[model samples]
Target: MTTKANFPVTAGSIVVPYGHVIGNEKWRGSEIAQRLQGKIRLIFEDGLGLVDFHLSNRTCILYISEADLVAGDEFKRRLVRFRNARSLGGIVIVERTQISDQYFLAVQKLVVLELGMVLLPVANQGEASQLITQLVREQSKDHNSNPFLRKQCSQLAEPSLFRTVQQIPGVGKTKALLLLQQFGSIHRLCNASVKELELVVGQTVAQQIYSFLCS
Candidate 1:
């Protein structure tokens, strides 16, 4: 899984699987990748990482094909490890199909519930590019806001878990405090499912909260 020769690192550089560039039943060929080369950078990488793709700012993703899902327990085991590693802040999964029930449950448990990874069932590279763009923009906004807000800090203060939880969308200071009290820790709160979050914050806000945290 070595990277392609002469791959350039540029603005919005994203590492993609070598297989996708070679043309698969689902991905067709390098044409899609070539089309995207102008707007975004694409680097090829060996299968060293748990994720299939990676962004410059640490967003990683696993593109799970239907065949990968049907391959049995190996994928599930890897997913379990990937979830618990908590290596990246925001990760994603791009799948052609929704996946089988067993794999779907695994995704619900490992990716969505345990690891909090964004799951995108995209039909083509164009849709994937859009999601990637949205992720980069959101990450940029978070990165840019932190420093400016830090400069306005009155003094160096101890970090509060409540404040951290409030960073998730729809979780204001009040809801953040409540979540901390209910869950007892940030880890537990993040591990809670969207359904569980709905119990705390209601349906609409819960979905938004999950999307913000996972994305």
Candidate 2:
């Protein structure tokens, strides 16, 4: 009984059911579906997307209560801990295709980074990280252009400019958090005017922020 999950249109043994992908079932169950839907397909997050799929009430992400939501809860919690645990973030390999159980188990064993990408767990599964690294290595031959993956191998940091702002008179934690959220980071806020800060915080506070950052 080949279900709608297995869309023949895509290809391979990948059978990602339309609704069950997210509905209130165990993540363990879906893990299998994400992998064996088909042969290797290329699923680009920017190139390919869920244009055909629509949300449904019966979806697993909806009705399940976390009280008994063992698998899902645990996965998310571990991910959060992983993110906060070390300076180097986790490596989440989000696949364009659904992920399968075998691959997931293999990934769990890999030297998982603190900040990783997410995988589809079903369709268009490919050796993404390997491919990306391969590309990076290839690009390294030039040495002129910036390396494709050369992020400042530093901590996920609050901008040093914020250290300056905090030193300014009258600025406090509440205002800092609010300002950071609105403008994104200190570098952005540094460019903003008193009026923009006012729009986010208020006229009075904006004046303070402006006067502070301006200096």
How many backbone clashes does every candidate have? Answer: 1, 48
lDDT of 1 at 202: 88
TM-scores of the candidates in the order shown: 0.49, 0.26
Candidate 1 residues 1-215, lDDT tens each?
21244443333343433222311123324434555454544555443345555543334555665576777666666666766664453344434554454465455445545554445555555666665545444443543443213331211110223344565667887786667556755457766889998888889988987776565
lDDT of 2 by residue, 78-191 (tens): 445544543222223333222234344333322122223221222222343233223223322434342221233112122222332344356676665666557654446667
After superposition, candidate 1 runs with Cα above 4 Å error: 1-35, 83-86, 96-105, 123-125, 142-215
- The C-alpha stretches of model 2 lying farther than 4 A from their native spots are 1-155, 159-164
RMSD of 1: 9.9
The residue-level lDDT of candidate 2 at 106 comes to 36
Evaluate model 2: give its lDDT: 0.35
